[model samples]
Target: MKLASLKTVSNAHNDSIWAVTWAPATEARGALLVTGSLDESVKLWRGDELEQDGVHTGHSLGVIAVAAHPSGNIAASTSLDSFVRIFDVNSNATLAVLETAPSEAWLMQFDLKGSTLAVAGGGSASVKLWNTSAWRLDASLSVLKSDASVKGSEKTAGKFVLAVAWSVDGKLLACSTMDGTVGVFDVSRGKLLHLLEGHNMPVRSLVFSPVDPRVLFTASDDKHVRMYDAKNNSLICAMSGHGSWVLSVDASPEGSALATGSSDRTVRLWDLSMRASVQTVTDHTDQVWGVAFRPPGGEGVRAGRLATISDDKSINLYDYS
Candidate 1:
């Protein structure tokens, strides 16, 4: 797989662009790219031309994460102040505003069926799950510390959940902490399955293989991306090359490739089958905070597309194949 720079939107936002996701296509419109920034706004861009569609600006602080519903009609954005705003993708109508007390939000994601929205609870040491139907607090999967003492101080102990992901089957939920521990949970039972360990620094991003529910990938401040077997809690492999922290990692829908953004100011595409980076694009002047692959399936769409947002206040679109 290779990435050909299709377009670059310089100064896409006033401040750092931290979050990005693809709103799936509908009969009325094609797939749109949604991005959130430290400028306290979420903006939409349509087509390969990267035309600006609209912007929503009510967030009090920097927007840390953005997620799109599977149906492409709804999307959500979270801010540093612990607020989650869900809105209509096309109309930008506010659907719901979710607030999590005792926890701040970091990353947001929708499950495969789009029935639930998962938020990375920054200081709560948990994953806050919200029901999409009534926009209610569904459940909180708290990560238990290894220490048996001081259990009451779980909220203050500083796990600082930084990233979250769900298996394609929707049966498994994985979350990573600032200390690099990854917790896997059983969604139906609401139970913690196991903890995977390797890195000593913060784990900023992770994604489950779209084709294989058991395989999981993670990027960390340790400057390495590790793959694991979620069910068995076994480390499968580790790939390293970035000169700085690896901030984000995403798997292609075909499951044959992975894309990662880093503090090294570059985006690297990995060949999963070979466990190595095959292509590197060094176009961003600042750290690349987010990298996302457009989910396959939209009218007249065939070629794969990948996007990267950066601290340089810019967004880059690439044609992937």
Candidate 2:
């Protein structure tokens, strides 16, 4: 499979675009592209033509992460100021604002059921779960630091949680830390299951395979993407090629492929079975910060789509086939 450039939106934001996700289609509209930027605004783009649908402004600092609810009508965004704003995707109306003060919010994801939203707690070393129906704090799953006396304790100490992902079944939650440790949690029990260790630098992005809940993929500042069996806490394989930090990663809906964005200013398509990058796209003039595969659903939307945002202040849409 390859990605064909469908449309490129230059200056999509006043500053660097840091995050992107596809809001699944509702009966009223097809899937919409949601992007958050350092410009302190979150914008929505509709259709393959990439027309602007709405621009949301409330963040005080750079918008760092954006997540779409499974229901498609609601979405959430978080900023460097440590606030999560949940709003209506179509109307841009505010639904709730979650203030994550003591622990900063980094990346976030709504569970597949749309019943809970998990926010990566930056310095607290935990993942905070918010109940969707009441928009209340449900639970905080804490990741314990490895023994300080261990060989590489200095590098792992006082690290911040940077990224998070949910398993296909929503039964598991995985989060990555600035020190490169990936912690897997049992969602129902609020327990840390295991830590998948391999990368020595910060891990910025990770995703669980859509087809297998136990399989996970991660991208790191170590300039490598690693696959692991989360259930067994075993490293499956590690693929490397990016010249700089690998900033983001997403698994295709079919689970046969993976896509990554890197500080190397490229987007790479990986063939999962071969455990190697099959194609590298150098479309951005600066660092690529976010890459997302469009979620399946919506009328007449069978063709796959991939959206990528970058430090170049551009958004690129690709036909993934």
The number of the candidate with the highest TM-score is 1
lDDT of 1 by residue, 1-321 (tens): 799999999999999999999999898888999999999999999999999998987889899999999999999999887789999988889999988764568897999899999899888888989999999988999887556666666544548898899999999999999989999999999898998999889999999999999999999999999999998999999999899999999999999999999999999999988999999999999999999999887789999999999999999999999
Q: What is the C-alpha lDDT of each candidate?
A: 0.92, 0.94
Per-residue alpha-carbon lDDT of candidate 2 for residues 6-67, written as tens digits (9 for 90 to 100): 99999999999999999999999999999999999999999999999999999999999999
Q: Could you tell me the TM-score of candidate 1?
A: 0.97
CA lDDT for candidate 2: 0.94
- Where in model 2 is the C-alpha error above 4 Å? 145-156
- Specify the poorest-scoring 10-residue window by lDDT in model 1: 149-158
User: In candidate 1, residue 226 scores what lDDT?
Assistant: 98
Model 2 — TM-score against the truth?
Answer: 0.96
